[model samples]
Target: MHPFSRSQEAKEMFQAQSHLYNHTFNFISSMSLKCAVQLRIPDVIYDHKRPMTLIDLASKLRIHPSKATCLYRLMRVLVHSGIFAETVVPRDGKQEEEIKAYVLTPSSCLLLNDKATGLSPFVATMLDPALVSPWHFLGDWLGGNNHEDCRDKLNNPFEAVHGVNIWDYGRKNPEFGNTFNTAMAGDCQLMNLVIKDYKEIFEGLNSLVDVGGGTGTMARIISEVCPGLKCTLLDLPHVVAGLPESESENVKFVGGDMFESIPSADAILLKVCTLGIALL
Candidate 1:
C-alpha cells in the first residue's frame, strides 16, 4: 500500500476504535452520575443557590484536597453529559482570576431529594451495585451460562449473578431492600406528576390493580388523582410485608403473587423492571 493510503487507513482505524471504545465505556457516565448524587454534589450546588467554584464545593463536601483533580474530572464528564453546567466565575467579582464553577442544568434539577418528584432515589437504586452487577453476566447469560450461582439455580442474568431473583435477594438484604423500595416510590411519584397531563388515560377507569407495585408507590400516586377510583397494589409477600399497613380512601395494598392471582380490577398496571434482567 502507498504511504498516504496507509496513513488514511490508520486514521480511519483510529476513529473507529475511538467510537467503539466510547460506546463500550458509556456506562461510566451513569456510574459517575450515581457517585455525584451519592455525594450530594447536585444538592450542594443547589444549596449554594449560585454557580459554585470547584474548591468551595469540595470544601463544602469535606473531600480531601488530594482528590481535588479527580473531583474536577468527574464534574467535567457530568457537564459534558449535560447533567451539570460549567461556567467561568470571577473571584470577588474580579475577572483577573476566573475559576470554573458548576451549576445545575435543567436536566439535574429533577435529581433533588427535597422535591416531591425528584429522581435521586430512583437513580441511586438503578445504579446500586446489587442491581448493576448482573450486567457483567449479560454476555455469559447470552452465551448459555445463565445458571447456578450457588444459592439458587436460574437462567436469568440477575439470578445467575446474585444467586436469586432481585426481589428475593432484596428481601434478605434490608439495606438493598429499602433502597429498592424507595427508588420505586420516587419513580412512581415522579411519573404520577407527569401523567396528570394525560388525563384521558385515566378517564372511565373505576378501579386499577398495580402488579409488582413496590411499596404501593404507583398505586398511591395514581389514587391521589383518581379519588373515586380504587387502586390495589399487589406484589410478592416479602415485598409487601414492608409496605404500608393502613389503607387509604382509594388505595390499598395486597400482599400476593401476580402469578397466583391479582385482585380483579377494571385495569391492571404492570411496572416492568428496566434493569433488563429482573425476572417475574
Candidate 2:
C-alpha cells in the first residue's frame, strides 16, 4: 500500500497516533543520552581534540566492526538531541566522499569526568539502575500494589522497591554512597562559584559551619576564599567517614549527626540559599 492510502481524516488520525507513540517512548532519548555518557563518548570526542569521524571514534572505542553502523545510528540520535554536533569532514586521500564527523557540544563539556565543573557524577547518580528501576514500578503502583490500589499502598515507592530509604540504601552500598557524595560534591563545586559572584555574603564573618556538607567540597571553597574564617563541616558519620580530620586547609571535617548538636560558629552556610549568624 502506498503511504497515506486513506482519507484525510484517517491521515490526521494516524498523525495523532504517531505523536502519541513518539511521546510514549520518549524515555528512549534519555536512556540513549545516558548510554552515550556511560560509554564516555563525550570525553572521547574531546580527547580527539578535533572533529572525529564515526569510524575513527568507533575504532578508538574498540567497538566491534559489525556494530559500526549501530554506533552511527546512536550518534545520529545524539547529534539530533544536541549532545553532539555533526560536520562534513574530508578524508585525507578522498575528496569525492566526505565523512561526517562529530564534535562535542557545550552541554557535553559539563559531563567531562575530569573537569571541575563536571556533572558526570550527577548523570551517573540519576541514571543508576537503582534509581531507574523505581520508575518501572510507578505505573504498577498507580494500578495496584499486588492486590490493592495505589491509594492503599502507603509505602514510599522508592523504599518499597529497594526495601530501604535512599540514605540507608546508600550507606549500605559503599560504591553508591561514594557516587552520591561525589555527585553532591560536583553540584556544590558548580554552586561554589557563586561565592565569588557574591563576596559580600562572607564579609565580616569570623567562622562558619557547613551543615550536612558532603565531603566538605563547598566548605573548602568558602574557606579558601576567606582563609581567616574557621570552617567546620558537620555531616553524618557515614558521610564524613574517610574525610580527613587533619583540616583540609581551613575546613575541619567533623563526623557527627547534624540534629544532635552542631558545632557553634559565627555564621552557618546551609547549601546556597540559607545562612545563619549566631548572636555574640
Candidate 3:
C-alpha cells in the first residue's frame, strides 16, 4: 500500500471514531446538564449580571473549594455542548493569571425556573429518573414475551412504565398530571400567539371538538377568542369533571372515549392521541 493511502485510511478511521465517541459520551452530556439544573447553575448566572468565575460559582453552589476543579470539568463539558459559555476574564487586571468565567447560552436560558415561560419543568420532567429508567427496558421489551395485561390497557412503553396511557396517567396523578397538563398549555400558549396566522381554518367552522383536551384549557382559550364558534372539549370524565364553568355559551364539555365515538362537530382538534385508540 502507498504511504499516502495508508494515511488516508487512518484519517477515515479517526473520523468514524469521532462519531462513535460522540454517540458513547452523549449520556454524559445529559447527566451533566441535569446536574447543572439540580445545582441551579443557570439561575446563578442569571442572578450574576456579569460572567461568574469558577471559584465564585462553586461558592454560590455551596460546593467546597476542594471540589472546584471537578465543577470546572463539568462546566467545560457543558460549554462544549453549548449549554454554557466560558470566557477568560482577568483575575486581577493581569493577563498572567486569567480566571474562567461562565455565561449561560440561549439553550441554558430555557433551563431558568424564574421566568414565566421558562421550560425548566418540561426539561426536568423529560429528564426525570422515572421517565428515563424505562429506556433500559427497550431490549427487555423487545425480546421478552408480550403480556396481555389489560389492567390499564397501556399497550405501549409510555403506558406500560407509567401504569396508564399518557392521558390517563395525567388524569390519575393531578400534581404530576398538572405538570404534563401545563406543558400542553405552554405549547398552546405558543400556538395561540400565532393563531391569527391561521384564522381562516376556524373562520367558517360553526363548531369544533378538541379530543383529549384535558381541563378544557385550550378550548376555553379558543372560545374566548372566537365567541361565535362553538367549541366542544372531549376528554375522559376525570379530566373534564372539575373544569371551571364556561361563560361562553358556545363552549361545551363532554366526557367520553374518542375511539368508540367523537362527538359530532364540523371540525375536530385531536391533540396527541394514542395509536391504540387511533387505529380503532
State the lDDT of candidate 3 residue by residue for 15-119, as single tens digits: 999999989989899888888878989999889998999888888889987888899899999999999998888897797898879998998887777665566
Return the lDDT, model 2, position 158. 69
lDDT of 1 by residue, 1-280 (tens): 9999999999999999999999999998999999988998878999998999988998999989999999989999999999999888999789798888899988799898788768888789888887777777777666673345342346577787778777788889978888888877777776876767775698899999998888887787677766778888888887887555545778878888788898999999997666553332
Worst 10 residues of 1 by lDDT: 145-154
Worst 10 residues of 2 by lDDT: 271-280
How many pairs of residues collide in each model?
A: 0, 0, 0
Residue pairs with colliding backbones in model 3 are: none
**How many pairs of residues collide in model 2?**
0
lDDT per residue for candidate 2 within 1-280, as digits (tens), equals 5455657668799999999999998877788888887899989999999899988899999999999988988998888889889998788658887878999899889889999878888778777887777677676556674654433354555665777767688899989989978888888888677987886778898889999898888888887777787899998888988777535467788888776889999987778421111000
Order of candidates by TM-score, top first? Answer: 1, 2, 3
